[model samples]
Target: MSFDYDLFVIGGGSGGVRAARISAGYGAKVALAEESRMGGTCVIRGCVPKKLMVFASAAPAEAAQARGFGWEDATAGNFSWDAFKVRLDAELNRLEAAYTKGLEVAGVNIFHQRAHIVGPHEVELADGMRVSAKHILIAAGGRPYLPGIPGDDLGMISDDLFLLDRLPGRVLVVGGGFIACEFSTILNGLGVDTTLVYRGDKVLRGFDNDLRELLTMQLADSGIHVRLKQNPARLDKQGDQTRVTFEDGKVEDFDAVIFATGRAPYTKGLGLENAGVTLAPNGAVAVDEWSQTNIPSIFAVGDVTDRVNLTPVAIREGHAFADTIFGNKPHNLDHGLVASAVYTRPHEVASIGMTEDEAIQRGGVEIYDTRFRPMKSLFAGSDARVMMKLIVDEATRKVLGCQIFGPEAGELIQLVAIPITMGATKEDFDLTVAVHPTLAEELVTMRQPSRRHEAPAPA
Candidate 1:
């Protein structure tokens, strides 16, 4: 089949960009189309900017802790949202340019327009240009989702956070997921009266229960009003404030309301149906182990596939797809045992593999749980405590999961994930020498199970 290019990629997010670049490196004629920015959600609206905000938000707490170290005038000063926004925007611009430069250097044609599938092998751009390819890849990613309720438009999504002109005086964060929890802590630390309201009984629903409980306490200690089992029934704009009516008919007003309820795959109007590509019930593009859609010529990766929605996973999926189809190196991404981190103030939460709940459901499981005030926080007289937990399969003693809640928990989990990914067992972890005088040492030193459960026999 004669085509304009060997591969046509839609959506220049992490997945699409990686696939296009790698395919081009393999000497395949490739082209990529991006409707908006090059770096997509992670670099532009998500992880990068969110982490910077996390860093910015921690200054106040750090300053107060300096008093224990003999620094007198260490009180945190007023934060200027305007100043931070300026620098953040500049950094985003620089990152976008770097992505563009890399794509160009890789010999991938860049189209600064929205592209949609017109046929299995054909894509039409926003500028009325039609491009044909032997294969098409979709990596459109996902977007913040808001429920359909009265006056819901009064609320903002996560994407709108980066574009806010000024920080809100009193903010309400809606959702139980990591986004809601992280932003709640961020805003609270930045001196905003932050209230986090989730419909569920707890925040971080799928995480280890101990970690969730510890984070809930830490969030409360940090002055974030945590309201569980409540959802916004309606939102209305009253003057300069947003009036939120809860499901129980309780009303609260805030300067701004942000909904981090969930994310929906960005598959709307992409012509996937027209191309005979199947989509999941949640609107995610349906794909198999190799990220190939029902139509073999059309493939999808990243959040659009609704697989493991992490940015790094998406990038890996993209690389694997390119290698398999273009580089003659067949490979597939293993979605299991992927580590993740949530940036919440006063403490960070990170986990890999299954949660305690998940482990319990599988079969016989053993849990090693520990909670204590770290030496640094203890010496500083801070009430903050760190929680470390390990879930192991009882039959094999293989570590099924690890969860940590404390400073550098995210960084610690990355190293911990290496052994876990390599199928390290509980005995192996105990055999390792502990890194004394460190919070991570607890992972290696815990030799006793705090709890054990045996799954019910097959019915």
Candidate 2:
């Protein structure tokens, strides 16, 4: 059948833009539709801008430490929230222009309009323009979920945080997810009276138990009041301030409230129903390993599919989709060994593979863990410590996971992910020679197993 474009991709996020560019490179006529900028969440509101704020917040901490280190900076400069916000927008605009230029150079047609799936093989734009393609890809990504509560409209989601004209005087951030911790870290570091409330026993509930505990203590020390086992029941507006009521009959006042509880797939108005696409219980578009929806012509990836929900993972998935559908090379994404990082105060947590809890649940698991203060931290007068854990299967001696909470934990975890992805054994990590004067060496040199054969070795 004749098609307007060989491949028409909706949502100019990481997956959509990559798929469109790659498909076009393979000599296919490709058209990409984006209701907003092309860089998606990572470039827009999720990672890039968030990390920049994290870096900005770190400056004050560093300056405070400089006096003790004999670096004489008698005067400290005040950081302006207004100036940072303006500069952040300028940088984001530059990135958006770069993305647009990249797509143009790749010879892919770009559409700045909301796209809806019209049929199994057709998509309609907001302007009522319809395009029929041989294959339609939906990488529209996801959105922040705001709970139904009184004055929830006064609060901001992760997206809305970037658009704020003024930094909040005080922020009552509710949730325990990675996003919640991250926002709290940034706001607290920037001198905002930040209070974090989570319904769980601890923040970062799914992360390594040791790391979570260590971070909780560190965050408390950093002046962030972490209220655990409690969640917001309602938000009341009291003049210019927001008062949040917790389930446990606790109320706190703040200039703003940010709900980083979770994000939902942004497929509500995409017309997925008309195209015969199915959504999972989590409200994400259901897709097979091949990224193809129930209808073969329609495919989905990135946060929309609820698989991994990481930027690099999304990029790889998009590449695999383009290779399989357009280049005739089939590839499936392996979620195992996906590395993730959480930038928190006093510690940065990073991990790949299963957590200790997950390994123990599987049964017959061994854990080799280490906790120590780094050499630099000792002289730096920091009382913080680093924690590392390796979960291995007793039968095969294969390392199932690696988790760390320390300085440069993200960098250390990424290096370990390589071996984990290659199915490296515990012995492989143990045998690797340690690099002296480094924090990560503690991970490779973990000799004393924390948990080994709970009862006895299998006969």
Candidate 3:
């Protein structure tokens, strides 16, 4: 049976756009609908804009460090969020336009409206237009989740950070995850009196414990107040300020309260149930390795599937889905061993592979680690430490994980991910010659295990 289109994709995000474009490239007629901006969260709200802020936030500290290298000071007392916001908004507009243009160039019909699954092979747009296709793809991404507390709406989400007209004099940031830590680091660097309150004992809960411990210290050292085992019980707007009352009965006032708490799949009101698509309890669309849903005519990818939730991962998933279904080159995007980075200035972090906890659970593990004041920081008379760690399988001598928490950690980890993904052994890392007088050389130069755990004799 002929249809209006070959594929109907409900999101215009990184995944949806790539899928729609590639499917059309393979001569499949495609239509895509996006209720919001074409670039979705990454280009519009999450990574792109946030990373720019990370760069902007680093200026003050880097300038101070330069003076220590015998350069004269031409210091600015404060960062101008107003001036930066104008440029940031313009850049985002250019990106959104680029994404839309690319989709058009690829021959995908674009719909600037909301869409939801109405049938196994049909989608209904916000304008009440029902379109039928041979297959449907849901690439709708996730939304920032705000915990329900009294007057929580008075607080802001990470998306709101990019839109702020001015940076707050002081801000209270909530949550313990990467998003939380990242913004906290940015705000602190930007000279906002930033306080980070996490309900857990340490920040970055799922990362290697060494990273968690070092990052927590780094945040505190960089002048961000790290408050653990605490949570905001309520938030109240007091004129231009927010008065936060914590679970422990501590009250604090700040010009703003930002919640980088977490995000939930943006599947609400998408009418997935109408298509008989399975959904996880948190509302993420359930799909197989090939991204197909229970109903073969429908599929989901990207953050909507709640798998790996990174922009690169989403793009690969989209490419894999289109190639498998349309181009006849069947392959699944491997979710394992994907590298990620937190662009926190002065102490950025990048990591790949298992945490120490996971490695220990698998079998015997060996951990090699180092922490020291880097040459630059030492030259500047700052005692800030950089931490690098390797988690290795004791029995096989294979590197299980590589984590670095310091300057350029993100860039270094990207290169390290290549070797680790190729199943590089600890011996390989040890045998490699160290690059002289560089922070990254520590990764290759560590001679002995800091600790080792033998498999518990099969329990």
Candidate 2, residue 397: Cα displacement in angstroms equals 2.1
Per-model TM-score, in order, reads: 0.98, 0.96, 0.97
Model 3, range 317-395, lDDT digits (tens) per residue? 9999999999999999878889988887788877899887777776688989898999998998787888898999877
For all candidates in order, the CA lDDT equals: 0.92, 0.86, 0.90
TM-score winner between 1 and 3, please give it. Answer: 1
Model 1, 36-141: lDDT tens per residue? 9999999999999999999999998898888877787898798999999999999999999999999999999999999999999999999899989999999999
lDDT tens digits by residue: candidate 2, 1-459? 899999999888888888888888888899999998879998998898999999988877777667657777733477788999989999999988888888898889898999998898888998999999999999989899888877688788988878888788889888888899989999988888899888888778878787788877887888899988888888888888988888888777889999998989989988889977999988799999899989889899899999888989989999999999889888888876699999886689898988877776677889999878877666668777888999888888888989999877888999999888888988998899999878888878887688764534467
Best by TM-score: 1
Cα displacement (Å) at residue 289, model 3? 1.1
What is the Å distance of residue 384 in model 1 from its true position? 1.4
Better of 2 and 3 by TM-score: 3
Pitting candidate 1 against candidate 2, the one with the higher TM-score is 1
lDDT of 3 at 156: 94
lDDT of 2: 0.86
State how far residue 135 of model 2 sits from its true place (Å).
0.5
Displacement of residue 76 (Cα, Å) in model 2 is: 4.8
Candidate number with the higher lDDT (1 or 2): 1
